[model samples]
Target: MRTLRKYAGPLSDRRFRLLWAGQGVSTAGDAAMLVALSLALVSSTGSASALGFVLAATAVPRLLLTLVGGVWADRLPRQKVMLAADAVNLVAQVGIGVELLGTVDVGLVAVYAAASGAAAAFFVPASGAIVPSTVAPEHLARANALVALTRQIAMVAGPALATALVVTIGAPWVFFLNAGTFAVSAVTLALLRVPAVAAVRTGFWDELRQGWREFSGRRWFWTNATAHICWNLGRSAYQVLGPLVAVRQLGGELSWGLIAQGAAIGAVGGAVVALHVRPRRPLVVANLALALGAVPLVLLAVAAAPVVIALAAGVMHAGLSVMQVIWQTTVQNHVPEHALSRVLAYDWLGSLALAPLGLALAGPLADRIGLPATLAGAAVLLAGGCLLVLAVPEVRRIGSRPHQDLPTAEE
Candidate 1:
């Protein structure tokens, strides 16, 4: 209990409090949308392959624009950029909600999906860049833990709320709620009293180069991120393959939802553990947990027992959440605050670049290799990729030392 208290640092800091509240609300709303979207698509298409396309659409734009967003984040004030991102999301959500008020077209839904995804590409980089500014270095792990807690709470609450909305109100209302959440977040950010951004005047090409230099120069940064690329590749496969398998081969959408919920609950526990328990080799811990995330895939594919599959998947998501908290803290501590967004953007691109490819191929691969076999293959790939991380010496032995003295912007 004392250890857990360490992770709940005083959010009484005005900046952190405002930011946390805004993010918590926005994330919960986003979760509602996620659940609503899943049901909406399932109702419309009745095919997991089509659902995969929606996920791919969301990821591909992030892959393409992530670096650009990062550059923008570095060049401009992160708070303002976040404000704009939130506004953009608000508009996108409103548009979707309004459109859905009339009819439920798959084409329109896909368009809304792409637009929302593009908005997210901007939002995520900005959020990542801004966090280090909001809290002190010593408090970063706690902040990350708090954010993870917010995310988990959102996950648990969002779906059930979405389910209720869909059953009683409708999917469009979920979008409306999401839009309102973003609006509230934007307003809260506008009220923050942060210091002016440090002027780093550089040309577009030069800024890109500088950002790239910062990103690639850190050995630990690139290696850990590279490992994540493989991890996400396998993850993308699991995202598409797992639910589909549960529905078509095993049970139905309800069963798949249960499986997903189980993972979410386990992830909440993982976040709690990561926050209080500081490992010496934090990066290595994160990498290994993420890589071993593939273990669930083996159970999912090979096992006929539903209980076994659910338990394995729950364990996998638990590890995933812990890795996320560790990685966020590492980035916040290691990278300069001014260039954090650029680095984060590159991080996003590197980690998720293969997601579209994975999603794009999963359907066809499942058809050819059989769903169980393809899932088993993804598990094998994940395990091998995790083991491959041992080759990166920095990953194995880094994050055990103190942070470098980098010039950080004030929040």
Candidate 2:
């Protein structure tokens, strides 16, 4: 019998190891940037509204142009596209940092945010599609889990480190550090030697249409994507309302922070488990695991104690981590490699369809209907949407057995 490889097995390939290290540093910087930017804006302006504006500016452009980015990634070398995106991101970070140190204007910050978002629109799709080319199909799941493990660690450590940095050196320096990490990422991309995929010559709109057809044809693909739409909508709702519940019912900011830490821990733990075990019905089990995501929201609605709420959040996040690893592996395994970036763009667009609405409506709707009622509705949507997806025959039947993805071979 062949001995199964651990998560570290993917790192045995020199090219993938370089890419993985760069990604880890960049992701950690990103996590820290989130805290640093939010804190810098809020502290300077002394308004919660500034925070929202900055975030919205980033998210909207990223959402709107994601498909176009997909087209470019498919037509060009994905690694080159990533390098260019990283360069843009580095510039944006420097711009924000300079603006923050000088005037602290929200408008200038919004501009920088928009630039960063545009860069991300291209970077994300390229990154997603590049993985299969980096490692064999057999190691895809392990690669994904290891990446998530790095991100989870960053999610936990980044904010705390940023908090300390902000207190001592200042926020602009954090931005500078973030920019530096992107440079590191770009350098690694330059060194990577993955064979170039044959450029598809179809026109942009036609290419996009072709990608859409591919994304829509797979029943398992569309079902899971739809499930993501519902899950993200509800998850966003909980994010908007959960803090309020924390402040009013639970111990407050500190408790909420602790709860978030618990979720991070669960994320890492879940990735570890996923690294070891290959589920037969990956999507079926992923959807089922996603159902656990609703648990914390339900608990929060009931005015559960801090400890209980934290535990629930941990459970919820573990489920999320499991689903993420399997879902990414499934896509890399099944999708045609040449078209993967465009298909991934569609996946991104679909997954985030209702997210903004969820975030925007949560506070107003909760105030009108009450927190408990709003949370209850969110919980219902979360569970109901997951179950609905699981009912699809393709989603239930797709097995997790390893197979070669077209063009995923050394290219």
Candidate 3:
């Protein structure tokens, strides 16, 4: 009962509960939409290159606009920014569904992807920034855990549901469902009674420069961000290649769905573990756990069976979930509330800057070096990058407890 109450504590806040519920639904839909989009492209063109192009199209715009989004998120009401992002996403999803229902026009799909990605630029920073305002300081970690838990659960359900729907009805309806979920999220954002941010008004370029300073000043933060860039770049190999491997070696969409589901299940476990454990050296523990992410990539390299690959994916995702929870909690606790969104925006930018490049290159690389070698290389890059981040003294020394004074960027 104590454990149950501790995990459920965040839900006691009406505002947080609303936010959680809405995000949960929307995340599930997002997961389903990803599966549907990937499969639709693959089925239509039978080319990993095509899928990668569309995915890169989605990522490039987000990468370009994220810093601007972050600056605005801090300047404006976070919830309002989130609502506008949701609205853009809703429209984009509807357009994608309508287009897919008529014909599989890759160009049209890419356009929609760009629109959704642009909206996500604004949404990500605001969403991260808003959490601090929704719950008490003490409940911050637990709240992050709960939010992650719901997202993992959605990931678990979304792929399975998408696979079934894609096999039966079609991928178009999945997009429609995602649109509905965005509407639900918009409504929840509308209802939230969040405290207004008291930001110091400044020039846009100056504000962006300030965010950069905040992000760059922290040795631990930028070090981790560098590793994240490498991590995302390496992980893109799996995202781009996994579906193709499943189609050729394993059964098809079902196998890929199972692997995705396994990862989500593992992430769920990780989130649960995070709800209970507060390691004294949070980043150290997080970096170590993140090393597990390499396992599934290696498994895929060797052409492991679907069930085996799924289990490996589960292990990897569990570590990712733990790392994510720790990272988010630490940032929220330490960063100034007014500057949080901008700092997080820099984090997003640094982390995902190379992801599109990776996605764009994955198919061609696999075509040249072959899938197994590419997977193994990605596995090495991810594991090595994660472990290397631990060499930073600040990442090792930072305590789990909240600090009244923010640490200087330098050691």
Best by lDDT: 3
Worst 10 residues of 1 by lDDT: 402-411
Candidate 1 lDDT (Cα, whole model)? 0.78
lDDT to native, each model: 0.78, 0.87, 0.89
Give per-model TM-scores: 0.88, 0.94, 0.87
Candidates 1 and 2, the one with greater lDDT = 2
Clashing pairs in 2: none
Q: Who wins the TM-score comparison? A: 2
Q: How would you encode candidate 1's per-residue C-alpha lDDT over 1-411 as one tens digit per residue?
A: 765555667374678888889999999999999888788777756877767777667666767787788888787887788889888889878877886677566666667677777777777888876776777667777787888888998988888899999889988888999999999899889987666667486887788778888878877777677777777777777899888877777777777777777788788888877777578888778867776588778867864556666677778888888889888887877777778788888888876767668878888998998988888888877767667776777666666333652332221
User: Of models 1 and 3, which has the larger lDDT?
Assistant: 3
Tens-digit lDDT string for candidate 3 (228-275): 887888889989999889988889999998998887788899988878
Greater-TM-score candidate between 1 and 2: 2
- lDDT score, candidate 3: 0.89
lDDT of 2 by residue, 4-119 (tens): 54557898887889889999999999999999998999899999999999998999889998998998999999999999999999999999999989878889889989999999
Measured by TM-score, how close is model 1 to the native structure? 0.88
